[model samples]
Target: MFVRTATPEDWPAIWPFLHRIVAAGETYTYPRDLGEDRARDIWMLEPPSRTVVATDADGTVLGSAKMNPNHMGPGAHIASASFMVAPEHAGRGVGRALGEHVLEWARSEGYRGMQFNAVVESNTRAVALWRSLGFEVVGTVPEAFDHPAKGFVGLHIMHRYL
Candidate 1:
């Protein structure tokens, strides 16, 4: 697989899966019915933030990620990122590769650390992956997510110093 910067033109290919993932409301904190333009604006950032996509040899977009500062001003030294892998590609290590790419990007951009603000407790696969990548559960907000299948679940704030 290859990873590269995402362009506005890529949105058409990305939106289908992105929309499905957000609409599922099982993982992300985004509004279940978030509009297309708003989602595009969030994904295709302007500056001090970036979006990337992972593709197979033939250039099929398998997943995508967005990386940015965890906060503004003095806190901007810390980085943050989010990832999404097509359900069909979940077990193939695409998420791991994308994650590693983002970490490398963060370091190259001079970030001091990486923070994940709202990881759902019920998303065990992602939580496990983050832990395996050296992220620790820094905090948890009880009942922060209204999971459809799991009822209300805690949202974990995970972090890793770079």
Candidate 2:
């Protein structure tokens, strides 16, 4: 698989899985009923912030990630990112490829560290992946997320110094 910067045209491919994942209300903190226009505005970030997609040899997009400053001004040195992988492509390393790409982008852009502001604690696969990639759970807000099946769950704040 290959990873590359995403283009506006790529949204067509990204939205389906993005919608499915967010609507599931099991992982992302995004509103479950989030609409297409708003989702596009949030996901398709502008310059300085980076967005990328992981694709197969045939150029089928398997996953996507967006990386940027966790906060503005004085907090710009710290970076944050979000990832979404097609369900059919899960466990195939699509998310890992996107994770590595985001870290490399952050480092190359001179970020001091990467912070994940709202990782759903119940998403064990993601929590494990982030931990394996060197992120630590610095803190977890107790019962911060409203999971569909798990009722209320924690939101993990993960970080890794570059």
Candidate 3:
């Protein structure tokens, strides 16, 4: 798979998977019914932050990730990221490629660490993946996320030093 920086033109291809991921209301904290325009704004970040896509050998977009500073000013050295893979392509390693690419990008961009602010505890696949990538569950807020099937679940704050 090839990972490349995404352009505005890439959103059309990215939207399908992005919409599915957010609409699930099981992982990310984004509103379950988040509109296209709002989702576009958040996904297509500017300058200092970046978005990237993972493409197959045939150049099909399998997944995407967005990386940016975890906070502002003094806290800016730490990076944060979000990922979304097409449901049809799940378990095909698209997400792992995007995750590895984002980690390398953050380190090369001078970030000292990485943090995920609200990882849903019920998303076991993501939690395990992040752990394998060296992130730890720094803290978790009780009943911070409302999982559609699981009712309320913890929202984990995961972290890792670069």
TM-score of 2: 0.99
**Tens digits of per-residue lDDT for model 2, 1-162:** 999999998999999999999999999889999999999989989989988999999999999999989999999999999999999999999999999999999999999999999999989999999999999999999999999899999999999999
Error of 3 at 143 (Å): 0.6
Off by over 4 Å in 2: none
* C-alpha TM-scores of all predictions: 0.98, 0.99, 0.98
- What are the per-residue Cα lDDT tens digits for candidate 1 across 50-133? 999999999999999999999999899999999999888888998998999999999999999999999999999999999999
Error (Å) of candidate 1 at residue 8 is 1.3
* Residue pairs that clash (backbone atoms under 3 angstroms), model 3: none
Report the alpha-carbon TM-score of model 1 versus the true structure: 0.98
Return the clash pairs for model 2, or none. none
| Candidate 1: pairs in clash | none
In what order do the candidates fall by lDDT, top score first? Answer: 2, 1, 3
